[model samples]
Target: MIAKFLRDPFGLEDAFPPLKKWQLWLAALELEPPIFKTDVLSTVNDMAGMSGKDKETVRIMIEDAQEYSREDSRIDLLAAAMGIPPNQMDDLWKWAAQIEPI
Candidate 1:
């Protein structure tokens, strides 16, 4: 069921083999406000145990989020994949707001 949802938009053929999760997440952060919040939150939650390069990647993403504005469809797709609700997405943004950009 979940797999169907994740693949519905981007397709599940592995044709693009999702760029490292962090990269994808970072891309999402650059998206429009709602999507940015949702993706960043979902990514951080899904990759909770992130380490090494992943951690560094997320830090960079946080920094990027502090200074960009665009729409990222990937984030919307990811939020759907993670089953994050719209309202909660705002909380996610608030969490992101607390992070000091590097």
Candidate 2:
């Protein structure tokens, strides 16, 4: 199931690209506490070309995660919602952490 989702995310026309848009949003959310708000707004602003619905979805996901008490639970819920495995979500989060401001 995980592999299948990784190969092709539902509603997306093609295979999940290595540089998924959600990855960028995830990265912004993971920024250091002091810079999180600025980083997220900056990142979202940089992705101004995305659809309004997509932007809303990303924002909601970030907010939901923020409400969680533990990062693991947040990641687990995110993985399930995104149809990816928890391990894959972990990898994506790590990847997000390494991303530099664009």
Candidate 3:
């Protein structure tokens, strides 16, 4: 662990991977007002200004993603639904990566 830390003092290597879906949700729920899963679902449902099929695809991605990548097209809508900008989603990803799942 010490060697790994010395190799990458800022954890940039570890932080680059996609963040697990659950981690992001966990963080969101821990927020002051608490962003419920329903909040994200409803917001995504309302904001996707596209065909039903497209919306469904996006919804599926959100519901089933194991890890969220910054390059994913759907991520823009996902982040926006959470009131987070696409570019800023990296911050979410970095923070989420640090969450230790139980």
Candidate 4:
């Protein structure tokens, strides 16, 4: 499934493609601390630099977003908070792309 995105007929792939919200959540559970989907939000809000508004924004995104854009700065922030290296984002993207939508 991920191959379709990474290896398209068009030579160019989006440097930072948006991933489905469910895919992102699934990858989170599969990858690190292995927390429940519910905990993912709290974890991000708990990050050191997050403020009240930022926390609210994250909550809203997680609750309502259809896709999580790799281009969004918040994605990087979330990855960093989760101890994922910037260069290793592809791991998350690949893992995410494999998830079957619930």
Residues 34-67 of candidate 3 have per-residue lDDT tens digits of: 7777878787677646787877887888788788
lDDT ranking from best candidate downward: 3, 4, 2, 1
At residue 46, what lDDT does model 1 achieve? 68
Instruction: Tell me the lDDT of candidate 4.
Output: 0.73
- Name the lDDT value of residue 20 in candidate 2: 38
Which has the greatest TM-score?
3
For candidate 4, the clash count comes to: 0
lDDT of 1: 0.46
Model 4 stretches astray by more than 4 angstroms: 1-14
* Cα distance off (Å), candidate 2, residue 79: 1.3
Q: Is 1 or 2 the stronger prediction by lDDT?
A: 2
Candidate 1's C-alpha runs over 4 A off are: 1-70
Against the hidden reference, what TM-scores do the models get?
Answer: 0.28, 0.35, 0.74, 0.70
Question: Worst 10-residue stretch by lDDT in candidate 4?
Answer: 9-18
* Best model number under lDDT: 3
RMSD of each: 12.7, 12.9, 4.6, 4.9
lDDT of 2 by residue, 38-58 (tens): 445446545657677766665
Error of 1 at 30 (Å): 21
- What are the per-residue Cα lDDT tens digits for candidate 4 across 1-102? 667766775644435457888788777777656746566676877777778998889778877999888878877867765667877776678657767855
Per-model clash counts, in order, read 0, 0, 0, 0
